[model samples]
Target: MNHLGDAHLRNWTLRLAALLAADTQDQLAWLGERELETKDVVEEVELLCRVSEGLAERGAFEPEDLRDLRAIGRRLGEIDATCRVGLWEYALAVDPAWDDIRSLARQFLLTRLGDWRQPLPRPVRPHTGDH
Candidate 1:
């Protein structure tokens, strides 16, 4: 077993789980607090899609979890296919597809990790330069 690989998997899993855990309103507020944008949220989802390509074989995720993961990815693909490039900002806030993804994420978290009952932690932004 690879500890480094496990750590990497854990980090990305938690990030994807966190992104899915919050609804639009909650996510908006979380990003607002961090001075971040909706693109950042989308970026996280994209990153997860790339990272989890063959993640299940690593033994970090259970079979059911992989099932849910694929479902989430499929819906996300639809969201991407339907949305116009420039319209994502508006869609992220208004699209029902995102809500569907969130629901799937919530279920995954509930059964595998936990529920979204707890408040999310603050995102950490490294200082870029002297303030």
Candidate 2:
């Protein structure tokens, strides 16, 4: 693997973390209707895993880059789990009936975010150490 800059790794981690937080917010909002399901959560988790794994596989990244990605994944998982539990509270707050449409909306938003964060097919790698 190529050596990725520390700055690059940090930036990626921060970006992923932010996205995860945003997704959690959206998810909770949808869960207000009691539309959340185990399948939905699993899909979100899979998306996160895929993105982290892809970043690690990028040939330009160093071990540190992968490590940073793993750290971000850990944080994201925590946020996701918390949001799931909070979903019940949110549903109570809204008093909305959980329905199939609400569940679909949640899944759609998460899928969109995942697609947005997906790395390009070909990543650009530095030829050598920075000048």
Candidate 3:
């Protein structure tokens, strides 16, 4: 993936970790209400949530844990691209004029990636509209 896409995925991974640290009921309720733009997003979130719950129960991230998290990040990056494509399709279907709205939504999603502390390998720059 490109740099921005990779950063977004890393951001999402951090966000997932934050969610895992939060209350389970709150996380479930939040996920339940989100208007995911595609089936891939829904599936990815469910899968990640399950994994996150498991990891939380284990109490710490080991080498294998980091590997699992990296895998999740890669998968999320794939799904994120798919979701964006789906969004574009919907935009085209509804009205081409909605492109600006779609752009804003995409940016918003990127921004929502979370405020968790940076994870390993390399640091992710804060998302600040540079993309």
Please, what is the TM-score per model? 0.73, 0.29, 0.28
Which residue pairs overlap in candidate 1's backbone?
Answer: none
The lDDT, on a scale of 0 to 1, for candidate 1 is 0.66
TM-score for predicted model 3 compared with the true structure: 0.28
Which rank order by TM-score, best down to worst?
1, 2, 3
Error of 2 at 112 (Å): 18
- Stretches of model 1 off by over 4 angstroms after superposition: 33-40, 81-89, 118-121, 124-131
User: How much lDDT does each candidate structure score?
Assistant: 0.66, 0.42, 0.42
User: If candidate 1 were superposed on the true structure by all CA atoms, what would the RMSD be?
Assistant: 3.3
Segments in model 2 whose C-alpha atoms lie over 4 Å from true places: 1-19, 23-34, 59-65, 75-131
Q: Which of candidates 1 and 3 is the stronger one according to TM-score? A: 1
Candidate 2 has what TM-score? 0.29
Clashing pairs in model 2, backbone N/Cα/C closer than 3 A = 33-98
Judged by lDDT against the true structure, how good is candidate 3?
0.42
Error in Å for residue 100 of model 1: 0.5
Worst 10 residues of 1 by lDDT: 80-89
Model 1 TM-score relative to the real fold: 0.73
Q: Which prediction has the highest lDDT against the true structure? A: 1
